[model samples]
Target: MSKPLFAILLGLSATGALAQTVPPPQIQVTATGIAKTSPDRVTVAYQVRGEGTTSDEATAKARDSAKAIRTGAEGLLRGDMELHASDFDIAPVRSRECNRDGYGQAQLSTGPCAILGYVVTMPVSIDTPRIADAGTLAGLIGRLGGLQVGVRGYWLSDDRPARQQAMRTALASAKAQAQLIAEGSGARLGRLLRVDDGTNRDMAIVVTGARARVTPPPPPPPAAPPIQIDLSPAPIRTNVNVTVVYAIDQ
Candidate 1:
């Protein structure tokens, strides 16, 4: 199920009012914390199109172009760089033969049919430990094709670690709030009832290519081992909400 925009759960005890025939006491509140860090990885995906008179020609051209990108990016991409054909299409470009009826599929004879080129795509993921070197990679990719430039996807580094740290801190803060609220009301808080993690999502930044989507190898000045997109650390977040019940020491 999709994560809710907000969540609230509460636990209470009847000892304070059940015997005396008074209403049970209840309370509610929410807490939040946010942190930011530089992204450690980037994902890039883009397409390459090639048109020819025949389907085979278009397909071949597209395949060839995609391969070229992969080759160019061989030494520039991270270890986990993925270079594969995303998609392909080969069809005739036709203007429907005018008929008495309105627009319909054009059943024209194959005399000099123009072929619509296939758009081949290549998607790549990079582990950018050195965030600063991104510009260098960009320059290399921008010139991958004659002139066509690709897109980029940048995300935080060591995401799981970051999120875990953030969640722990957030949860602690929440519990502190709960404890404070309970104490101010002269109630001794008991064990935690439950907790709900906040909305969880992965925002995938897109990456483009000069000719097609290309994940290049790490840059030449090999500062560290070939970068690998160990996605386990790319800025992931986990939220937690806990409900605690307190026994009123009457």
Candidate 2:
């Protein structure tokens, strides 16, 4: 081919290649912000476990403990606070001959699970928004049934307010960041094109009940009422994520 014709063919090929490689959909940036705020409510789960040779015996024991827990907990939770049943379970004590962790050889109960003996457990949730004395309630729960006891965690009182504030803060920060980036790159930032709200699972701060043994039986001490240790909410950190879409100006 002539030199001129060859040059024209190469130019067309280059242009075709450039057109095929379209620029990526716009650049999108996301940012997150966290806000530390006072908790609005307090929630804690109290567990009571019981065991007996027969299913009826175990169930009765659990019922008694649950009634006691509810009695003590009813007035403790605030008006707006809610009460939810945790879980009920029955497990058998295993002998070494049967299994190391559980009684694998023992006759199974008439259920879907491998249950030997009856193990009844109940959990009561306490909301501290309206309750006046938290320490008092704790002491009351500590004395119930004298069995294994545990507390899950205390979450932020109200979740909505903190989440909203965090989202606003994150969006503002993202916009500022995007604008700066666009300006420095010789481009203009456009209107927001998208938004996303993130969910949160509270991370626990304190965990109780990990001891192998308990205090020895108390001597004949004063039969004073249970020990109540009132508590107040602590500062909680909440976070929010935001994605902002801005048109890229040429």
In the order shown, what is each candidate's alpha-carbon RMSD?
13.8, 11.2
Against the true structure, candidate 1 has what lDDT? 0.50
- Per-residue alpha-carbon lDDT of model 2 for 1-250, expressed as tens digits? 6999999999999999998898633547799978888755555567777788787888898888876765555544423346677677876654433454444454543443344566777766766554335556666667765243433445665566677777778988988888888888888787777766544444333456877644333233224555656566567888887777777767
lDDT of each: 0.50, 0.65
Candidate 2: worst 10 consecutive residues by lDDT? 213-222
Give a tens-digit lDDT track for model 1, residues 110-187.
Answer: 533333333433344334454544554545554554224433656654455555555666667766776788799887
> How well does each candidate superpose onto the true structure, as a TM-score?
0.57, 0.60
- How high is the lDDT of residue 106 in model 2? 48
Instruction: List the pairs of residues colliding in candidate 2.
Output: 41-157, 90-119, 135-228, 135-229, 135-230, 136-228, 190-247
Instruction: Report the alpha-carbon TM-score of model 1 versus the true structure.
Output: 0.57
Poorest 10 consecutive residues by lDDT, candidate 1? 3-12
